[model samples]
Every structure is written in C-alpha cells, then in structure tokens.
Target: MTLQPTLPARVEKDRTTPPRSGPSRRRDSRYEALTGYLFVAPAVVLFLVMGLYTVGYGFTLSFAKWNGFAPNWEWVGLDNYKDLLWRDPVYAPRVRHAAANTIWVMVAAPVLTVVVSFPLAVLLNQVKRFQGVLRSVYFLPYVTSGVAVFFAWQYILQPDGAINSLLSGLGLGSLQQPQGWLGNPSTAMPTMIMITVWGHVPVAMLLYLTGLQGIDRSILEASELDGAGWWRTNMSVVWPLVRPITAIVLLLNLREALQGFQTFLVMTNGGPGDHTNVLGLEAYRLAFLKNLSPTLGLASALGWLLFAAALVLALINLRALRSKT
Candidate 1:
C-alpha cells in the first residue's frame, strides 16, 4: 500500500477560510466604533442641547435676576438663593408650605401605590383569563392625558360630585357634608394624595407584574415543594429576587411625586390657602403668575432645589433598597 502524504490542517482550512490579519481586525474594530458613534450621536446631541444646556442655563439664571422679558439680567450673586432660603417674607412662607406639601405627597403616594398595586399585580399574574383587559384597564390612566385625568378627578371630587354622592347614598352623609374635597383647605392635600395614589398605582402594578414574570420558576417550585404558602414564598423567595424592581419602582414613584405639578394645577391651583401648593407649582407661580414682575431667578432656584431634593432622595432609596447579596 502506498502511504499518502498528510496534508497540513492550516492549508486545508485556508482553502475554505479567509484569514483575519491584524490590519483587518483593526479596520473591523474601527468600523464598529464608527457605527456605535453614529447610533448614539443624536441622543448625545439632544442631551447636550436640550438637557445639559437647559439645566446649565437655568442654574445660571438662578444666580441672576430676570423678569422673563428683560433685555438684560442683573447679576445678584447668591441673592436669589438668599431670598429663597432666608430673606423674602412673602415668598418664604410659600416656599416652606409648598415644600411641606411636596414632601407629604412624595412620602405617602409611593408607599400607598406600592401597597395597593403589588397585590393587584400578583393577582393579575395568577389569572389565566382576561389579564390583558384588566391590565389595560388599570394602566389606562397612566397613558391618558394628564390634563384630562386631572380634570376628571376634579369633577369626581367636587362636593356634589360622584364620590360624595356615593358616600351620601351609602349613609355616610356626615363625611360628605362638611368638606368640598378639592375646595377645602383641610382636605385638599389629602385628596390630592389620594388622586396621586390612584394615578400612580397602575404604573407600579405593571412594573411588579413584569418583575413577577421574570422570577425563576424553579425557585418558585422549590419553595412550593418545601410547603411554602403563597405569602411565605413571596416574602422569602420572590421579594429578595425582585428587590431591584422594587427599588426602581420606589425611585420612579418618588421622583414623579416630588416633581408633580399638573394635578395640583388643574384640581386646586394651590388653592383654598396654598394648602395644596407643591414645589413644582410654587416654582411656576413664582415664574409666570406674579403680576408685578416674574421672579424667574427665584423660579430657577426652586427648580434646582427640587432637583437637589430628588437626587438626595434617590440616593437614599438606592442605599436602602440595595440587595445585600
């Protein structure tokens, strides 16, 4: 038998394969980098122009006095900050009141929303029928126009409105007769809190539902095999796994509650006695609603204040909710 010479593997592979030289690899890497830059260019430009520039301009404006239609701004150093923090009597009370209201809503709304929505999400997750319809129904308000929803709630909360009428029909006439929810100073903030909770619950529910769906089925099965009840399994197995989602939901809810303006704007207009005024609405009132001269500087200061508060709270939330593992 004649022995055939063994062919080299490199030669055999080279017949069917193209070699990737150093220059080719470098060129490919350059091409990928270019494509990435092209993809992100618009977003970067937008952030610079609409986000960074706007924020920087606003911060600068916080240091200068401008009446919104002025040809020139009078640079006042930290005078704007001083007035807001300690000096101006007329504006100082409003700032404190608005800050208090904002903090109340920020604390209450997120807690209530999570408490109410998490169960709804779990229930919806277990449902084998019409889950889409139920989810859409719950999520409708989130997608609806803010102005429209606020107005709708305004009507609903009026003294002779649907809620009061229902209370009266159910023999809770004493509760109905004393206060016009949106019109009363005492009840207005709580009513706003309720409306906020209602509007925001759906979003939390959706997020929780998504988190629930992403949980490992094997872990759930193992928990069940260990004879864990629904509440027990969720507490021990599910909660820790979905802590990140909870953190996200908490942070988002806190941010939205802190920055909310429209609901108060339409429902109460910070009214009855600045009872429902929040930081965002107070900022707007300072900027545009003052008849004598717009306090654009003060408004800008309030905006920055709100930003700072949100940032601090976000950090706190992150630290609090961070998973130990």
Candidate 2:
C-alpha cells in the first residue's frame, strides 16, 4: 500500500548550458587580472612616487648641499657624511651625542617592552571574566593619539603635576623632582624610556596573547600533568613556542625606538639641553629646524646612517632568531 519514490542513479547534465570555451575562460581571466591590477594601481603608483622616488632623491641629495628650497644644489661629495661622521667640530659632537642616546633607546626600549609586556600578556591570557574589557583597556594606549598622550604625559611629569603630587602624598616627597621630570637632564632620558615602554607594552602584549592562544591546550595540560609548575611550563614550554611572536615584537619595538622622534619632539623637543636628543630628532632638526639654516644634505646623510644601522640590526635579529629556531 506504501509507494517509495526511488532517486535517479545518475543526474542528467544540463544540455542547454554550454561549458565555458577556452577563449572565454582566457578573456574572463584577463578581465579578472586587469581588475586586480586596477584595484592595486593607486597603491603601486603612490609607492613609486612617494616611497621609492623620495628615497632615491634623498640618497642623491645626501651628496649635495641644499637648503631644501634653493634651485641650485651645491655638490659636496662626501662632505656631509664626513661632517656627521666626525669632521665638523660642532655637528660631529652633536651627532655623536645623539648617536649614543639613540643607541641607548634602541637597546632599552625593546628589552623593557618584552620584560613588561610578556608578563602582562601571560597574566591577561589567564583572565576570564571581563577579559574583553581588560584587553580593550590595555590596547587603548596603542590606539590613542600619540601627540595627545605625549602632551598628557608631559603635563603629568611636570613639577606640580599628578606624579609629583602622588609622590608627595605617598611620603616619597624626596623623590619628587622640583624642576619636573623632563626638565632635569638626569631624569629626562629614563622618564622618556618609561613612557616609550608603557606605550609599546600594549601592542607587544596583544601579540603575545595572540601567540599564546595559538598554542595547543593539550600541550599545556600535558606539561602540567608531567609535574611542571606554572613558571616552568611557561618559561620552558610556552615561551619557546612563542619565539616567533617574540621576535616580531622585538623587531617592531627596536625599529620604533630607532626611528621614533615624535614623543621627544612633543614632550621635550630633544631638550633638557639635548639629554633626550636622538639621531631621529637630530635628523629632523637638521632638515627642518636648525635656526632657518636647514642642512638638507647633512640630514639626508644622517638619515642614511640611521637606515644602515636599522638594516644591520634587523639582519642580526633575523639571523639570531633563525639560529634559535
């Protein structure tokens, strides 16, 4: 009494639908390729004009003295490089001082970023309730406007500002700087380093968190079951596994510390009498802000020197990371 409908063993092809011919396929592919190129054309053109062209021009300009506006560029050969590298008495000493300061920052910032951020990231990864809120809070600094935050920090580090007031309230009044933190040459550099670390920690922590999340939960559990403590599990197991992330964070922070001048420009303007002056600010100062006598060639030479140092350090880091891996 029951009728069961049986399905067809083979479904018939649609004879009315023609397969795409070779020429049509090729034409479609060509159209797709053209569309993709058109999509990227603006970015490619911009890079050619603003990035490569500017770099080439800067490289060429390094050998010529120009006020950045003059029609005639005086070809100075290697004089600009020589002066910055220790030929001119005035420029050489400043350059050396800036180089030293730059090196200090370049080494310290990335190290501190790792030291602070990794611990914070580990702790954050363990967080459960309100985790999203906490992460957003941590990430705020990275997303916040740099100039505004730097200005706020400048205010906070001032003599009568919140930091000094807090110190006084805590009965650490002796530690309070009457001349303001940034006003004192002794404290200026360290304070800036601290700010840099604080600003950088968020991004580094986020990277570490991402790396930590990618780790297998079973691996962590196995480590725990094998009588490994939290510290040992993280140090010996987790940290090693997160080496790639750590390398990325370190390289990024290193590059930033090497090339950054915005914070110094905003907060101290390379002052407390050049105590916080770095090669980045020095280059900027030479190119644009040296009492209307902008040494465009000298600035370009300094910029190239900075570029060389960055390239060498990057290569060294990559090599070391590869060796470890």
Candidate 3:
C-alpha cells in the first residue's frame, strides 16, 4: 500500500467510543506502541546493521576500482555503472540477453502453471477419497530436491535416455546427437520453463483451491440451482472473488520465474550461445566469475539494478490489478 504524506492511523477502533476516555486512550496507545518497538529492538538493530553495511558498502564500492580480492581500491565514481549501463561491450550484451530470456520465461511459465493447475485444483477439491494422496502426487515434484530432479531430468533428456528411448520405440528417430533437452539453445529455455511449470504447479493449485473453498457454500449451491455450469461458475464467481489471490500468485510467480537459476545452472550453464542467460546469471558472473578485482562495485551496482527492476515491476502489477478492481 502506498503511504500518504501523513501517517495513517496505525489502528482503527471504535470511533463511537465515548469522548470522555479519548485522551486517556491515546496516551495508553502511545505507550503500547513504544513498548512494542522496544520488544523488537534487537531484531531491528541487527537488521539495520547488516542491511546498511551490505547496501552502503556496495554502493561505495561501485564508485571504485578493484578486483574480488583485497579492498585496496581507488574511487572511480559511476564509471562501472556507466560501463554496464551504456558502454561496456560484454556487460551490455549480457544484460540484454539476460533480460530477454527472463522476460520470455517469466511471461510464459506462470501463465502456463496457473492454466494447468486450475482444473487439477478444482478436480481435487471435488474428490472425497484419497484426496491427500492425490494432492501429494501432484505436489511431489515441488518437494523433491533440485539436485535429484536435475540428475533425473538429465538422464530423461539425454539422447539415449528414457525419453528418446521411448520415442525410438515409437519409430521416432533418436533426438539429434550430442545434447538432448539442454543441447539446443532454442529448446533449452523452453524446456526449463516446462520443467519449472511442472514443479511449480502446486503453488497455483493451492491458491486456486483456497479461492474455490473460500466461496460461500450457499452461494455455490445457489449458482448450481440456477444451472450455472462448472466453467460458468468458475469464470463468473470464483475468479472475481479470487482477484487478490491471482495478483498474489502472479507477483510470486513473476519473481520466481525471473529469478529461476538452479535449472539453468545444472542443465544449461548459460550455454548454447548464451541463450539462457538472465539477470540472476548476470549477478553471478559479475560477482564470482569475471571479477576484474575488488568486484564489490560491480556487484553492488548489479544488485541495486535488480532491486529497482523488481520494485518497479511489482508496483506496476499492483497498480494494474487495482485499476481492474
């Protein structure tokens, strides 16, 4: 929520309460808020110390020249950021490539996840027997460790792996040699998106189930009595009330999708002509891989840039949703 210039009331209570006690209540409330802050003082202090150190140190470093090693450096105010934003050859292309890939995956994967999960969630909600088992089956992929899934996918997507073997049995020639799923640049990102959606479906399913169940049972029965079909009920009733949850899902999905990394790391490693590079990879490369020296500056700039992107996108999505409502 956007804060107004003046702080809004922290709490809303009985406005109709007698005026006689108003002065006393305000004094009491002030003490309560003060005590609450005192109770959380240690946490607040710890958070500020670490957060300020990291952000401030990075911002200061961005204006200097240094490798990833010792802090021995000289101020080069805004040079690195300029290079990254406007001049640097490798940096510009890397950011652009990463942004493109991130946009593509973020756009497609969440929509796919939500679309596929809705019917599954609706069906699960209607089930009476082994409902928990059915949900677990759908959600198993989400709980499986990335390392295990990566290895399993690697084998399944290999040329002579299970997928190709099955394809061959059906007279579909073995996948063109060398690489399988992550082999081709064109397909690597798409495959990652598909795998991501497969594992990520549960979150959307959970959201939809919550929304569906939140609908008043009487309202549903009334709609049914009016002869509304499943599709009609879902579209006109469930979706309207679930708008906030939809926004929540999209916000989370966008973040997860844009920042997805493990799959690319284990599967593609930003290979096949750097097709899978994204903002997350850019941060990794700047901080860890291509360090000229004292990489604090570059890493900090990239971090701030990512923060800005996230903030701007979140606000835009929020505003769009609010306008629709």
Q: Which numbered prediction scores highest in TM-score against the true structure?
A: 2
**TM-score, model 3 to reference:** 0.82
Q: What is the alpha-carbon lDDT for the whole of candidate 2?
A: 0.93
lDDT of 3 by residue, 298-321 (tens): 766777777787788799998988
The Cα error of candidate 2 at residue 98, in Å, is: 0.6
The C-alpha stretches of model 3 lying farther than 4 A from their native spots are: 1-39, 174-178, 291-295
Enumerate residue pairs that collide in model 2.
none
Clashing pairs in 3: 62-297, 66-293, 66-294, 67-293, 67-294, 67-295, 68-293, 68-294
Better of 1 and 3 by lDDT: 1
**Model 1 compared with the native: what TM-score?**
0.86
Residues 98-152, candidate 2, lDDT per residue (tens digit)? 9899889988999999999998999999998898999999999999999999989
Q: Tell me each candidate's TM-score.
A: 0.86, 0.90, 0.82
lDDT per residue as tens, model 1, 192-276? 8998888888888998999999888999999999999999998898877877777778788889888879888888889988888
**Model 1, CA-based lDDT:** 0.87
